[model samples]
Target chain A: MKDFEALKSIWHDQVALPKVSHEDVLKNLRKTRNGLASKLLIEMIGMGIAAAVLIYVWIASPFTMWTTHLAMIIFICCCIYYILAMISNYRRINYDKLLDKPECYINHLKKYKHDRYIFNTRKYKVYSIFFTAGFILYFIEISFMTSLWITVMGISFTFLWIALCYFVLMRIYIKREEAKLEEMIQNLERLHKQFEDTDQ
Target chain B: MSKEAQFKEIFQANSKKIYHLCYGYTGDDETANDLMQETFMKVWQNLDKFRNQALISTWIYRIAVNTCLSYLRVEKRQAKDELTDTIIETRGEEISEKNEQVSTLYKCIAQLEENERIIITMVLDELPYAEIAEISGISEGNLRVKIHRIKQKLTELYNRHERF
Candidate 1:
């Protein structure tokens, strides 16, 4: 039987060549840091641009109906809410407290995962409801101005699109996000259990 | 020294052991390399904030253990048996006899519990037992017991792989 010492000798006898150079690591560090920050930055910028355009439309358009103005306000609020949520999420995941003990880090990850699940499911539901309500209110004014067939077509198409999003797209997106979060949670929990086992 | 220079020194000192630790956990060279790089990236990011209360190596090890534990790519992680097969088939000719033995050793190490794998790799690297305990967040006495058990498990696995 090979003793532990023998195994240690074997382990030491093996040579490890560094596959990644220091420069490569530096390059990757810069790239990854910039990549995550830029992605979030782009998202926030997109939301800002969208909100700005909507405000401009609200100001420039000659809509006499109060419903249209309310719709525009609702749309702008959704954009602002989305931007704030994205910023919060970006801050949540980009934390620098990675030097915490394993159990603490695991707990941190579990909390983050829990928060993400709530945000993805419950928060998304709220956003969708508000968005659909805004669209419905907006459609009331359009229906008054347009022909009956046109209004019917427009309403049907909008509701169909909303139904598709609420039923199909949102479900798929939530399922994918949940799967990813669930896997991370499971891994963290296992590690947490391992730590507890050691403590015991 | 500049931050980059300081980081280079730290990386040069710890990267190899970190790679071995990751390799022991993953049993795959490419994955181990990726993990080592990732560990260093975190180290570089947080280097300025590092206080001197603990050894730099210990801090890096904590980051590495956390990184390995939190890695969620379940699909890319190969089972021990599959890893052994892939090693034999792909690098069979390219690897030397000693390298083959080392690979088998890593395969055996991969068979242990996740925490056990990390602990034993540190042990093999001859890290001070106190430092290992600190990095693993366990009492040194408990760590010794865990190491003894892991060594037995790893030896049994290594012998079994040898026979096969």
Candidate 2:
């Protein structure tokens, strides 16, 4: 090997990174998308507390026991609704693949547009169904006189928010593609310039 | 044993290689370490899906490359407001000679188009083309040509600097 190649080879061979302890790796692993589950568990606990509060308030109110029964039934249903949502979200979290190869997910986005599109599309469908169902369930639970208007407004806002988010994401993706093309062109120009100088 | 313990064992076995792959790409210890940690953090999170399709090393390499690429993107965005001359000059003062050479090589690497650099480096690391094709999602023939061109460029670069 020539001097530079020798140096480069030695550098490549001898330079090694030390292993972080198994303890640290596990600690970090525990914090991975496991945070999402931890969050859901926390949310579950919060929902339980909220449900308990609803029960306590409903029963203590001077209203009839039947109304209290209705309130308790509503609380139970809401808890069930959230539990199902949490499970669905957890299933879709990609926790297993993510822990093993977080960068693969990002690389897939940068290198494989079709895969990213497929992923985003699937996630969109899942989110839309979950949000729509939650909204419908909540709409059913509300006993106010203007509940219909509230439902209409609430549903409209959800759809509008989703549309706006999609619009912004598409714009960002388009801009990134444009920037990447521009960079490629500039790189090619520089490479050409280098060749031209060498020829001279 | 616990899933976390299993993950820890795997990471311990592979992280040094992972860090080197990261260092190969970034050529900076701090950035490489950060990328290495991020890769493992991601791996730890997704531990459940290490399907038998690919080796763990290949999966980690994929993650290392992806993290480096993302970091590059963010660095590019930051570059717009950066004092490029000052930053470039400062790099020489901070790093050792061998590291500086690696950094110089990486700077040259960045000038190549993204996939070209990726293919070439994977080849340099002596990974088989079939595995490279699998990781890059590029056909074997295309990867070969890209590697040829990248090596030609690097040789030209090395020759050019020799005259100085």
Candidate 3:
């Protein structure tokens, strides 16, 4: 390691040249450029669809039941919170200064995990309840105004949506996020331990 | 020059050096190649915004550094420890004194703080202090101090890991 100059000389000698031709870069750039716009468009379209449904439910809900009105209000509030939190997390991760230390990244990841836990466990539980309640109330009004078939169909749809989201969060997403952080932390910790070992 | 031409020239000039930057951060060929491509894609996209206020090389280096950091955060959580393994296997193909030297340096570098690793690699690549400071987003005075400390740590580790 004291061969610092020798190390530097060796580093300069190595080259990882691109196998792709300039023509390939130009072609890939065009494809990649299209990917950016399409991704933005898709996100906009998806958000538009979600916002349209939520806003419609809030505004055009023709329910005389106090329970129905209350449920809709709760659901709307939940939507607002979800959107705000998503934006907050994105900005928090992106806008923060790139801290140099691996420990700093580990610490940042810890905070991220903490926030995700709250979102998954606490906030999600509350959201599921409010969403289910909202649909149930809305369906009850449907039962009164229309046929039982329509109300049953609405309830079935609501339960299916809730179940899908629940399955995804519990089985797929949370585990994946946790495993990623834990694995990264393990590697980072080992690197730190190497230094400690060297000192000893 | 056309924007495409300008970008090609920039890519031609700095892509290998930037790949080394990515290599230092990732310490693996596959991930380093992925990161290098990502960095240049970003460079091509953001090229028009390069207002000539800073040196093009510094701007590009900053992009590479940030891209590498972000890539580490998202892509492969198991990177650093695997870095030592990568150096041995990747260098085996070349098998020379230079490869031996780089392999050892990379192992020592893996122990430094993530930012410290990037800074020292750039220093070892012999980028000027001003350019390093600009890319590292530190003042030159602070960079000198930081580099001095990192060098001492590297020397200690090298001596300890030295093959008898």
What stretches of model 1 exceed 4 Å from their correct place? Answer: B84-95
Q: Answer with 2 or 3, whichever has the higher lDDT.
A: 3
lDDT of 3 at A187: 54
Candidate maximizing TM-score: 1
Better of 1 and 3 by TM-score: 1
Residue B27, candidate 2: Cα error in Å is 4.7
lDDT of 2 by residue, A54-162 (tens): 6776668554435435545655665667677667656654433332232244433344444445445665455555555545554444434346777688768866776
Q: Using DockQ as the measure, which candidate wins? A: 1
**How many angstroms is residue A6 displaced in model 3 relative to the true structure, after the best TM-score fit?**
2.6
- Which one is best on lDDT? 1
Question: Which residue pairs show collisions in model 1?
Answer: none
TM-score for each of the candidates: 0.90, 0.55, 0.69
Q: Candidate 3, A182: how far from true, in Å?
A: 4.9
User: Worst ten-residue run, lDDT, model 1 chain B?
Assistant: B83-92
**In model 2, what is the error at residue B164, expressed in angstroms?**
6.0
lDDT of 2 at A86: 67
Docking class of 3: acceptable
Residues A29-146 of candidate 3: C-alpha lDDT, one tens digit per residue: 7897688657656765665577678779667866688877777677667667666765665456332233233334445655666777788777888888888877777676678888
